[model samples]
Target: MTSYFNDVAVWQPHDLAYFKRLKAYGSRGVVVKSSQGGYGGTPYINSVGKLQVINAKRAGLKVALYHYGTFNSLRYGQADPASEAKLMANTAKAWGLGKDTLMVLDAEDSSLRTKASADAALFFNELKRQGFHSFDIYGPGSWFWAGRLKIGTSYKLGGWPASYGSSSSGVSGAKAWQYTDNWKGLGVDGSLDYGGQYTTKSAEPEQKPEPKLTKQNVDDYYYTYNPKRVIVKRTIYQHKNNQLGSQANRGRKLKPGTAIDIASVHFSSDKVPVPYFKLANGTYITANRWFVNNAYYELSNLKTIKVIKPTYLYRDLHRTKVVKRSGFKSNKWPKGTLFDVKKVIHWQGGFVLKLTNGFYCTAYKKYVKKIK
Candidate 1:
């Protein structure tokens, strides 16, 4: 069977935004540092580290913890694996980590002289005895090297090897691969979990429900800067540009009342005889239909204002388009009609307003008073 890896983003205190910004990316799981050794008995979890673990759970990602272990008499001549394991277990227990959660002991210390693999077994044995059910061993490429830390398969321990820019972890039955330390501009080790110790079972942020388009007009968000501003009216069967001339696939099908974004307008070919809107993703949505330019929507906040006097409210400030919903080509609002203004500005030789409900008309600033 061919082995595959599942993505799981990891972060350390130094390389760090922590895990709070995880929603911005699609990492399915995260492994955070629980604590570290070499500082004596009572290991302290940095506030940032604690927050990363907690936030990973809130973001619906499977969370795990790892600890950087120390050298022992068998490895480098100093640092006890037994002492380190006990401290690691005690720290996690106090932090309230469930025994079911995967814990990892980083066994990649390079200064070991001999018997490193035996020391690793001792560490794992201690963790298992301390009640960590799904713990694993994490080491660099050197641990599996001939004379360095020779990991034993008899222990039946799962491995997460730090193999940077390489195609393989070089360790048999490895659970995950620490593929790289720097990915997507983050200064942290990244891994691909192989489902031995961790699984990508959670709701990812990218799979959102598509909006329904039921009428000739509907309002939905389009990306301007943050997918929250710059509303535009989109119509059905609008062609996406890059898909336009491709033999492999035709342009994307756009349904009537479907809301789409315009990255920018393009008229690449005059011979084509139409304009197209560049989508936020660099693709294109066509403006082949004339009515597309007239989709009803608002680009700003809606504000209520008091109409001081009865005035003719044209659908357009220039009286070009009338609000047919009012049953009048040109409607009139009596004194004291409360209207929400989407846009208040100066028009041709007069003041005009765009209504929140998608009516464009002109009204004098003095004749209409802003409520707040």
Candidate 2:
């Protein structure tokens, strides 16, 4: 008598009906493909992974997720493993998957035969950093048989090697064994959850929220002179070097309004020294004042603004649709006018200071000077 579970990829039907059917067929749990490398788009991430995760949980089946590793990709190289691991953890959190949900790495590329263990350690370590507790590595049983894949005691890493054999799992020390591609005529991969590894649960500590900044504490922010974090002011690409050119945009472009943690700063050796912020994730972005905002005054203590230039009020945060003059006496506020700030609305890398009069004005420092 063997207790088993089903593993599914995008190839399987993702409807709630299908998962209900699997539950009816005596499956207690399911491993759903969730995401892949940095791209994590379309088929790389199971197109219906979010739906499948929701449905699987609704159908009363314990759910797990797996990321298809692409560390061997030529463009991304070794960085892909950590990036993909972060993608997996973030994607799972976005889908409301509990941290206890088993996160497995599907490593099947032949190129990994030489460095499988190293890549696995890198992937699992990143996952742990993101607060994921339970982990497993899945690949062909032959890789495990040949000692290409190995788990260490540094973390609670488990193996889920697959080999379609009748009686044995082919490899030893597996936490779970995928013993069949088609289990019980269902035409889906099935595995035996040895030692209840797939059913056990753990709790993750809740993360604390960032502190709110105000005018009183503004001086504390600048006392250090060096910023520990920065907000992107424009769409910018990451680079491996601090050189100034489009050719050096080697990594992905971060969207405006994204906050990045800084690891350290490096000045380029070019004719005009350019400062670059090294991200905590080992990527680099320009510390240029035109591209990113590092000072706390840019956001904190924005109580009110004195209109120094011709300013128009907007009905929305984007300021695309101007506020009509019919409601107010005029559509434009003259220079030297003061607007009482109700609250500041942080838009994409910019601020829209919502006035107490029920209209929004741009918080660009050049256009308006802070009065309060």
Candidate 3:
């Protein structure tokens, strides 16, 4: 399917009306990036803009948040090694995004080569570690031709390709190919110029069958844990616009001792929209930050916590395994059945739960519940 991003920052008053129309018509998903500023300049959107876009997504629009990556010179300052990592991490958390959301790293600038590829790899690895699965590295085709960066494995390519063959060649298994830096269509402002178009086919047509829900399916879905109550010593840092390292401040180091409860533990599945926990002190936290100690905990003993708020879950459309219930009908499962944990597989769509009884499933916001 064709995906359209309104590029809201580019819209004027009249253009805004057209933007809404486009959303109602052709747009399947939107990537809300910073807009061009005054006098025909690019606009810079903040967290508020992101929140607004997410709200729009809740209203049936598939929305994603975008950043120009570390390469944007004028917007994020020069490539500062010290600020880049922290900026990426803080941005991931601030966006409230996990693996499901698109993290576009606009790398169209020529300045990125100044930094060593090793440094870029380090930055990309950290972004992966911070729970971002999808990455869009936008740049010209020469960057791919000359630099010889592992395009398909490292990230999805965006930007204008030198030729149609180059666009179809597939960089780092590009999910979408942006054809031109400038694409003008009917009713758009001033010949809209940016990325081209998606080279890959839409993922919608190849969806897999939903797995049957069973006790085995539920129990196998995630790992369980009982964490010891201890203070996780972490250093929080402030990120500069385009830097990779954290700046040194007098109290930059968090206190060596701060008591926080480990609370309940569950498996960290790429397939599930992890629950956000509000600490006793009102501090909200993401499930992605919860680290699993495989050596100590058994998947069965840990308590499974049910998600309290509404969230989205991504089920892999490719995995198809039929489950056989003891007395239930061939296609249906009884509620409250507990299954054994089998294996967790990470696929392009999301994580998949493979059960001992032969079922593959994904978790959605309201559909999951922990067995007491």
Candidate that scores best on lDDT: 2
State the lDDT of candidate 2 residue by residue for 27-54, as single tens digits.
8788999887654332256788888888
The weakest ten consecutive residues by lDDT in model 1 span 221-230
Candidate 1 — which residues are off by over 4 angstroms? 1-24, 38-44, 75-79, 147-155, 201-372
What is the TM-score of each predicted model, taking all chains together?
0.46, 0.51, 0.38
User: What TM-score number comes out for model 1?
Assistant: 0.46
Clashes of each: 3, 0, 38
Give, for candidate 3, the lowest lDDT window spanning 10 residues.
288-297
Question: For candidate 3, what is the TM-score?
Answer: 0.38
Of candidates 3 and 1, the better by TM-score: 1
- In order of lDDT, best first, we have 2, 1, 3
Alpha carbon RMSD to native, model 2 = 19.9
Candidates' C-alpha lDDT: 0.56, 0.73, 0.41
Most TM-score-accurate candidate: 2
lDDT of 3 by residue, 1-372 (tens): 435443433342222444455556555445555321211233244545545565555545555545544433344443342245446445546666555555555454444554334344554565667676655554445555656343544444343223233335344444454443333454431111133232122222233344443444543322322222333233222122212122432222323233344444433233642322233433332222222112112234323323343222222336444444556444444344454535555445234444555555543213345453
Task: Report the candidate with higher lDDT, 2 versus 3.
Answer: 2
Candidate 3 residue 58 C-alpha distance from true site, Å = 4.3
